[model samples]
Target: MKPSLYIATALMLASTSGFAQRPPAISSPDVHADNTVTFKYYSRTAQKVSLSGEFLSGNHAMTKDTSGIWSITVGPVKPDIYPYAFVVDSVPVADPNNTYIFANERFKRSIVDIPGNTPLVHALQKVPHGKVSYRLYPSKTLGTTRQLLVYTPPGFNPAGKTKYPVLYLIHGGSDTEETWTKVGRANFIADNLIAQKKAVPMIIVMPYGNVRPAPMPDFTKEVMQDIIPFIEANYPVLADPQHRAVAGFSVGGGQTLNIGLTNTSKFAYVSSYAPYTQTEEFQKNFGATYAPNAEQVNKQLKLFTISVGTDDFLYESVKQNIAMFTAKGIRLRSDIVPGGHTWMNCKQYLATTLQGIFK
Candidate 1:
C-alpha cells in the first residue's frame, strides 16, 4: 500500500471507531421547575439500577432504556440540597453524569440542588460572599501536616483592624473538611446570614477531624494544640476563648464534647448537632464515674447547646445525654426539631448555630 492510501484507510477506520464508541450525552439530577429532579445513569451492562437519596424515604427503582441508560424522576422534593446515588447491581456509586459529589471518606454519592420559590439559606444568592481558603497546618499531635478550610467573611482583611471571632466547625464521621462547604453549604449559609446581618462577620475553620490509623483521641489534642494556634497566628482573629466557638456533627459531634467540654478555657460556645456519642471517648469523658465541675463549666461556657432532630436515630441517646447533663447541674440548651441525621438537617442546624453563637 502507498503512503497516501494507508493514511486514508487509517483515518476512515478511526472515524468509524470514534463514532461507534461515543456515548450519548445525558444529564443526571435535572431539577425541574416543579422541584422534581430526574436522575440518569448510563450503564449498558448493569443488571439492576436503583435511586437512593435523602429526598426519598426509600430506594426508588430506575428504568433502563434501549440506549443502556437508567433513569428515575423523583420528587417535587422539598427544596434542598440532597445526596443521591445509583446502586448498580449491588454496589452504590455516584452518578457519572453529575459532577457535584458528597465530600466524604466512605460514601460515593452525587448531590442535587433543588431550588425553592423562596430563597433557601443554603442557596447561592446574590449576596456578598465569603472566601473559603484551603490551608495546611502542622499537627504536632498527629506527627504530620494536615489540611483545613477557613471561611473568611465578606470584607475580611488580614491587615485590617477589625479582628473577627472564630468558629471551629467539624464535619460528621467519614466526612472530610470539605463536606462542611461542599455538601453543607456552610460558606453560602454564612454569606447569606452575614449579608442579612443575622450572623456577625466571623471566621470559620473546618478542620479534618478523622485521625485514622491512630487513636481518635489524638484529634482533640490536634485541635487544641495545633489548629487553634495556627489560626490565631496566621489570621486576624480574636485570640481569647470568649470569642471562640467549637461545634460538630455526628462523630465530630462526639469530638466537640471531648474537645470543648474538657477545655472550657478554649471554647466559649459549644454546639453539637445530631451527635453520635456512642464512642469510647464519650464513655471515658462523661462516663458513670466521671463527675464534672458543673458550676465552673457553666461559668466558663457562654453557650452550651445540643441540637438534634426528632426522627434522628440517636434521638434516644441524645435525650439521655441531655437528661444526664441536666442531672449533673450543667446548664444546657437543647433544640429539638423535626428531621433525621441528614445533611439537609445539618444545614438548618448550622444556620441556627450561626445566629445563636457570638451574639
Candidate 2:
C-alpha cells in the first residue's frame, strides 16, 4: 500500500477530526500501525527539501518526486512526542499538516505526537504527582527581582511530617526557569520515574541561571548565593549537603560545575548536559579556569555526570572535558547519545540522569 494511505488511516484512527478536515497537500509517504510516521511536503519552487530532526537516524535528505514533493518515512518511531521540521531549499519550515508545536530557543517547530504505548516514548506512567509554584524572588547579586519556578515532589508540604532532598536544575542561556518544566518536561519525567520506582522522590528547584545584559560578570555567583539561599529558606527542603544535587543544560551546565564545585559543601551531586568544557571567550570574560587537577575537585563530588549527543556542535569540547576529567582520576559517567544539541537530546539526558540520581 502507498505510504500516504497508511498515514491517512493512522490519522483517522488517532484524531477525532476524521477525514472531514482538508487533507495535507503533501501527505506522508508512509505510516505504520506500529506507530511509525512519515512526512511529506510539496514545494515546487524549491530545488531540494530535506528532513532534519533528533528522532531520525541522521539529518537525512528526503527524496524529491518529479512533482516536487519531498518525503521520507521514519519509524516505527518511539511513542513519545518528537519535534521536527523540514529544510526546503535549505530553509527550515514547519510541517503544514501538523499543529503540534514546541519552542526551541527562539524558534518554533512542528511536533508529531506518537502513541505513548510505543517503546520509543519513555515510560511516564502515574508517578507520584508534584506541584509547581511560580514566584518572584529578589536577587542581591543581580540587584533585581527575577521570576522562577519550583517543583516540589508528591509529598511536598510544609505541614507534612518529612523533609525532602532537592535537585537544583538550571536552564541554559536564552532560556528561563520554565524551560525545565515546560519544554524539558522535567516534572513529567520525575513523576514517571518516581512512579516506576526508578528514582528517589525529591524536590526539583528550577531557577533562572542567566544574568541578563551584556558583559554580565559572575553569573554563577548569582545562582549560588542568591537563588539557592532563597529556595532553601522558602521551601520545605533538606538543607544538608547529602540531599542536594545541581544540574543544567549547555551554558547552565557550565554554571552547575562552576557553582556546585566551588561550593562543594552545598551540592553533592552534579550533572552537566551538553556543557561547554572550556570556552576561551567565557574564560576571558568571566576569569574562570578549570582546575589544574580535577582529582582535587572530583574527590568532593558524590556523582558527576556529563552527557552530549554525537552530533552536537559542542561534542568536541565535551569530549575534551571528559578526557581531562578522566585523566585526573575523576570517574564521570559520560554519555554520547545519537542526536544533535536539540531539546530532544536534553530531555533524554534528563530522564536517564535522574534515574540514577539519589539511588
TM-score of each: 0.92, 0.74
Backbone clash pairs for candidate 2 read: 3-29, 78-120, 79-121, 80-121
Tens-digit per-residue lDDT, 213-304, candidate 1 = 53246888888889999999999998898899999998888888878888888889999998888876567776532255788889989999
Top candidate by TM-score: 1
Which residues of candidate 2, in runs, are more than 4 Å off? 1-33, 38-52, 56-75, 86-100, 116-124, 213-217, 281-296
TM-score of 2: 0.74
CA-lDDT, candidates in order: 0.88, 0.74
User: What RMSD value applies to candidate 2?
Assistant: 7.1
Once all C-alphas are superposed, what RMSD does model 1 give against the true structure? 5.1
List model 2 lDDT by residue over 199-254, tens digit each.
Answer: 88888888877665521247677767787788778877778877889888898887
Query: Model 1, residue 39: what's the lDDT?
Result: 89
Give the least accurate 10-residue stretch of model 2, judged by summed lDDT: 284-293
